[model samples]
Target: MASSMLKSAGEIQNLIFSQNQKLTHLARCGRIDEAVKLFESMPARNAVSWNCMISGLAKNGRVADARHLFDRMASKNLISWNTMIAGYSHNNRVLEASQLFDEMPKRDSYSWTLMISCYSRNGELERARWLFDSMPGVKTPVCYNAMIAGYAKNGMFQDAIVLLTEMPVSARNMVSWNSVLAGYTQNQEMVQGLKFFGEMQEKDVVSWNLMVEGFLQVGDLESAWSFFRATPCPNVASWVTMLNGFSKSGNIDEARRLFDEMPERNLVAWNAMISGYVQFLQIEEAYRLFGEMSERNSVTWTTMINGYIRIGKLEKARELLDSMPFKNVVAQTAMLTGYVQCMRMEEAVELFEKISTKDDFCWNAMISGYAHCGRMDKAVELYKRMPTKSLFSLNTIIAGHAQQGEMHKALEVFKQMRERNTVTWNSIISGLTQNGFYCDSIKHFVLLRNEGRKPDPCTYACGLAACAYLAALQVGKQLHLLLVKSGHVNDLFAGNALINMYARCGRISSAKQAFDEMASVDLISWNTLITGYALNGFGRETISLFKEMEVNGFRPDDITFVGVLSACSHAGLIDEGLKYFDSMSRDHSVERVAEHYACVVDLLGRAGRLEEAYKLVTEMPIKVNAGVWGALLGACRMHGNPDIAKFAAEKLFVIEPQKTSNYVLLSNVHADARRWEDVDRVRSLLKEIGIQKQPGCSWIDIKKKVCSFVSDDPMQPGATEVGFVLEMLCAHIRNTEIMPWSSLLDCG
Candidate 1:
């Protein structure tokens, strides 16, 4: 009986060992479900079986399941604890990993190293360093490597180098040297990377590849080529890197030569070559290579499909996608994006609906498409249907609604967002500014600042624009100070906004100062400052700036000519105005628009040349608009020319019949000429049309508050005090003038 029992025990022990080995192999192969089934059905399991299952689960991104299994383990060992910590680390669950590490009954170098690497990978470098220093035993090379890599990854080159130097010679390996080199290359510090590369006594293919890639990234093609030739033994990756470099630098022929000369070609090399051709819009060459490939993967197919889509060959892209043996979300999304770009929303939606596994990028692309096409309803519908609303989608919805003039909807979305970024604030602020909600835009900007969100350049530009429109000089100045402190004052867009704000606030000198302070200038900058000077009645300065703009090689656009002509009109420089106007199309190729014509008419009218102004109005090539006729009528009233005024008034009535200003100007002109009948006729026509003259309104910014006044309104706060002060001023002026009061009247 004892011999029989011994035989059964031996068989059972062999079975358990065989089962553990099989379970480990299955887990390593990623057959997690099969491994789980096998584990459960095993007559008995040991620690190895349990640990293998847990490791496989965590590696496969089933961290929660692994943790559950771990908690239920009958007996936990050091390997079990270390595996669980590694699981949390792999999934970026740093808090859980730290907690579990603290609960460990025992720890080893592997356990400590896992925790340190976890922190390092998750950008918690300080915690990583602390853990490294606190490690109980001798630090292993792996631990030292983790810390050094962490420093280098975070762009702390000095720290990484110092740590590397402090490492014992036994611990210092090729990885330590390469980690620093990789850091320099990744950070685009190739100059330093090259110097470091020369100092290394040992170099590998990885080191060589890194140098080649670094040169390519910075567009130094010659250096990349030189490095490529010097590499003693270039691998497939090395060849592909050089090929991609040539392709990206617009040297397609060289890429082809290198591709053909490669000693061994892999699928990766072929794909790289095709991607390079596709990137440069060489679709035919990419397709030809695709045909030559004996085997192709999803990446190969997707690259070809995207190449077709990029060149607007949507049908070809669709055909390739359909022919794909297996479809992925990437190719589907690329096709959808192609449709969106072409405004073929129906097809895009058709494809979008067929995608069973939509990623965030795919969903965001669809939403952005609908939003860009002004289909907000569909965009909102799709956004609501998303399983996970990403920040990008939220920003897109807000921008779409704001662009469509649906501020109420935009605000509703904005209010619902629990988290916001700079883009979110910028969309709302700029949208409000664009739609004429200047005050509301400024309020949101202030709210953004109060929320402790750092505003970007776009935010400041929008805020400055609101200040310009409100003539809020104090607020503008405050924003200017903030910009300088933030070190974004030199940004082109912000600089232009500052110039405009100072100009509109009647600070012409300040506007000029802002203009001069700009480190670099675009055409918009020149146009802005020139228009500012013209509006401030600095006609000579405006013309001088325009001349300087041309001398600086900026061919004036239509806007530039408008400012020049307006300056001439305001300064009564008729000859210069006519000369510039003629040179517009001939010298600058700027087509004359109605605003240009209006400026010229105003120029002649202000000079008392009503006939010449009227002739220009009738003979202009383009169809005349209300502005032209209004300019003529204003000039007629000034010179008391009733006949021409009546003609201009009749045209204005036809073009802008609801405008009360035209009637008022015509009535004044008739009264000036003593044409009582005509004046009554104009007034009667205005009344018949049911048009009411809009009240003249002006506002002043006092102590950061905008105070508004309306014509003939006396109910405003401080109105009585303002009238009293004006009366006293008039009395004092009349009584105490050294010269006669008649001279004052003449001057006025």
Candidate 2:
């Protein structure tokens, strides 16, 4: 019996030895599941075998399985307990890790440090600090480093600095210094980061890399280059950072130079260069780079798609998107965003539907596209169908409703928001102003400030525009003061709005002052100031501003030329107007739309060159609209040319038959020519069409409230007194030697 037992024991020992070897090999090779299976099938197990299996499962992120095996173990050593605790820590199950740690019969430095790292990784810095303070044994440098890094990562600069200063002399390390410096750099405090870096006793490669990244963040290529040259040995990240800095600064040439100079190019470096080309609108160059890449990722594919979309090459974007090996939400959304940008709402919707897993961004894009195309009803419908609603989704719905002048609907959406943001407030304020509820727009802006939501640039711009439309100069100035106090007066958007408001209020000097004070000027700034001058009848200032704009390296856009031509026409600069109109397509490459043609025709017709105006209209390349004919008819009235009036009136009857001005202008032209029969016929036609000329009215601002007056108006509060005063003034003028014209007297 003893001999049989000995033989079985020998066989079992051999089997156990072979299985242990196989399990170790599988775990090392990262075949963790196979290792676990091998472990489960074993008939006999030792302490080493159980520890190996538990460690393998924990290392492979199967923490639950590791814990199950641990609980089932009849006996466990300190290593087994530590392994289970570390597994929970690594998996971010901090509570379970802490519980296991408390129950441990013995504790190690590694066990405590793992728990600290776990808390830090999860952004629970306070909990991490408590564990560090209560640790029974000596604190490890690694544990201190983890806590400091967590503070820096969370932007707790003061707390991180406090810890760094209070740490034991031995705990101070390169990682501790780097974490704080990186915190400043990450927070966009590059200047402060530089000051801190200057005081560092010893700097490593990571320190140098961070300084380079900091300079690059602010687009300071010169500073970045100086730092790059100072780097002991630049890594791929350093090279990519420099490349990206140049790309964003619009220096494509410099970016390419850096790309070619890289000793070893990786996927990231290639992507940075490709994205640079995409940003600069060099689409063909981006495509070439994309094709040259040996490896491509999801970002690369999406970037190429975005490049095509920028240049209106939808076909190319579609082709590449279809051929992509994998399609993620980002790639799909890129195509969807392109459709929205191009105002192809239906196509955007179709693409949106094809995305099987639609996220909030995808839904927002479709909703915004519908709103942009003035399909608010469709936008609202899509908003309802959204399975989930984020703040952005709700804001989109409110903006769409606001954009279409549905104030009540916009308000309804605004009230529905459980957590209202500044964007929501801006949408309602801007919407009210756009829909001609200027007073309401300003009122909401005031309410926004009172509600503890400080206004952003959009809010200021919209409010200023409301003031401008209402000609409430006092209110505009008050908002301007608020903008100044807020330190956003120099922002391009707010500055542009200020200029527009001043200009629309006939305060040309104030508009020019705003324009002059701008630290940086964009196309909108120049256009706003010039348009303001033209609007207030400062024709010479508009022309002078245009010249200054050209001299200052500013190119005129379509709107700029519109302002220029309108100014020339208003000032009766016929030759100048014609010269600019001709040069629009030739010199500026600005194609003349119908509006420009109208300006040129008004100029010639107003200058008594009816024949020239008529010839220009007849020879215009584009289809002539009602404005062109209306100009000719107005000129006929001034010159008493009945022949041209009939021609213009006939076209107006077809193009804009319901327009009251066309009928009025034609009747005046016939009256000037003493063509009574034609006048009667035109007046009868107006009556048959049921077109009544709306009474001309003017508004005056009285202590912020607008008081309106119409010709022959009896709606004035003190009409009888006003009539008596007006009669006395007219009688006094007539009593003097200077007598009024017979036609003017009869009309009065």
Candidate 3:
């Protein structure tokens, strides 16, 4: 009988039109009215019947029609409500989703999970958690996974962990594990995530894929490659992970080769390739890949737009934004970032205002953009006006104040942070440390310790730097103990800072110990170690380390070069240092900046090649400053060459004529030549011009207190002792008939 009915072509056509698949096809092909007509003719509607109709209405944004169908369904089940709720939520109808949730007669796990997902998708994690907690009935792993993934996606990893702990043992499935592991991996906590994987007895491909991805995300490409080789059955995901890692790390050819060799390419695989191009700043390649995408999604558009923004191609970003067939928050965000990055703050602000529903990220982008553009006050204002704030928003604002030298504002923000993280404390400490407020930094380090907040490497580095600046040996020693206790002595930054502090405080042995303890070192690490050795006259070690840096594949930068050159200058390795300076541009690709030139001049001057050094100074690429000329003049004084000394002093005077040092240097050069009339004439000119010689002063920081000393100062606290020492020294010298050596000849 069924075959006979199918043989009737008209009846078969009618039955086909009534099928759910037929209606869905009609809607998918944009025949909404036909879909609705077909849905209306269904005599016995099932979940599919309602889903088809609801999807059609949702597709066309016919909210009232969807809601009408939802409420009128006498046999509506969990899928029906979930579909309607998700449709409403996705269409930016959160209030309707909420009301439907409130009015539903029966709520299942799917119902609660869907609502929570809606909140999470909209950046309302708090509401998502609220809905998650209020869910009735025994929860499924899907419900737990959805909420946990939401937290993880939102960068609330600690909260995600907390939620994971609350799930029943039965619900602690592989899906739940993947969420937290992926979150940790994204946050650069690979070790913690790997531990979770090890504890999972049922190790599946998903777990392995996530583990590999975690390594890849944090720039540990070598480790990820090792894992990929060890995997029993690697999927396309693993391949894509390697491709992304290589491309992001600046291996585009490798990424392209892997991409071409892929067995199959899904949308994700394609996006990875496009995104790789973006990461390498190869915008043209990204566009080429984008153009090759026969079909495109929001992710593809967003990636292309973001690439344009990153490369300072704002017009391209806007054109892409304008050409989009549909626009989402991600696309808008890319456009906003383009404007922000280009310092088009007004454009960013205008776009931000146009976003009717701003999320935490939207606010973060604007505030961070303002901060980056030096509009700190505007950043703070926008940050304050955000209805909801995240750690990112706060951090960006704090960094702005810190960078602008507004330490007080940074401190205030740190104090007011409701949930202070390691970065928050580090920022405030760094600000105080950088602004010559070492005492305050130390005080906060102690306060942070008392508050049970463990310091990270950055905190230790900043603290050690502060200690070096203040010569706080005791404080640095305590920090060293903390480093040992915390098992962070192997950290390169802390180790480097320790070497600096010990060297500055005259504990060269301790500095060497710290250097020896370092397990890994970079150029800055080598620079610090060498600078310490050089300043303490351990010239052999300094030169040895400079050689070691080259052998270790650490190409020296200007700072490293300067440190090595200074050591050479001090140790009389003038010829070797000059060779290094000459080789900087040819061998290391380092441009000969002013500091490098100054170091060369010092090296030559120290070697008593006064004429050659003076010629080098004249031919320098940059204008010679007073310091460089002053150094040359001082060297000439030692060599008893008053003619060159006078010429250098005059050059210095022309640079800053009002500086009394120039007058003093020139007059002394004349006095050295027995030109007393010239000295008298210079003195009279200074008196006539009302140019007073500023007193030379120095200060010592004692017990967290500052005490200043001036040359021949009469009002110092130690004046009595200083006066007595001078008289006794003079009397002893006269009694012994000491005579001047005239090494610094007054006449040439």
Q: Cα lDDT of model 3 overall? A: 0.79
For residue 543, what is the lDDT in candidate 3? 79
In candidate 1, what are the lDDT values of residues 336-408, reduced to their tens digit?
9899989999999999999866766799899999999999988999999987577889999999999999988
Worst 10 residues of 2 by lDDT: 739-748
lDDT of 3 at 376: 94
Using TM-score as the measure, name the better of candidate 2 and candidate 3.
2
Instruction: Report the lDDT tens digits of candidate 3 across residue range 300-344.
Output: 889999998888888888899889775656678878988887788
Which pairs of residues clash in candidate 1, taking residues 3 or more apart in a chain or in different chains?
none
In candidate 2, the residue pairs with backbone N, CA or C atoms under 3 Å apart (3 or more residues apart, or in different chains) clash, namely: none
Each candidate: what lDDT? 0.88, 0.84, 0.79
For each candidate, give its TM-score against the true structure: 0.65, 0.70, 0.68
Candidate 2: tens digits of C-alpha lDDT, residues 415-531: 878777889888988899989999888888877877867788889999999989988777787788778877677678999999999999889999999889987789999999988
List candidate 3 segments past 4 Å from native.
1-172, 176-199, 214-223, 230-236, 248-251, 309-314, 328-370, 373-391, 412-419, 477-521, 640-748
Candidate 2 residue runs with Cα over 4 Å from true position:
1-234, 339-351, 481-490, 695-711, 715-748
Cand. 1 TM to true fold: 0.65
**Each candidate's root-mean-square deviation in Å?**
10.0, 11.1, 11.2
Candidate that beats the other on TM-score, 1 or 2, i.e. the better one: 2
Write the number of the candidate with greater lDDT, choosing between 1 and 2: 1
lDDT of 1 at 172: 91
lDDT of 1 at 285: 88
> After aligning candidate 3 to the native by TM-score, how far in Å is the CA of 258 from where it should be?
3.5
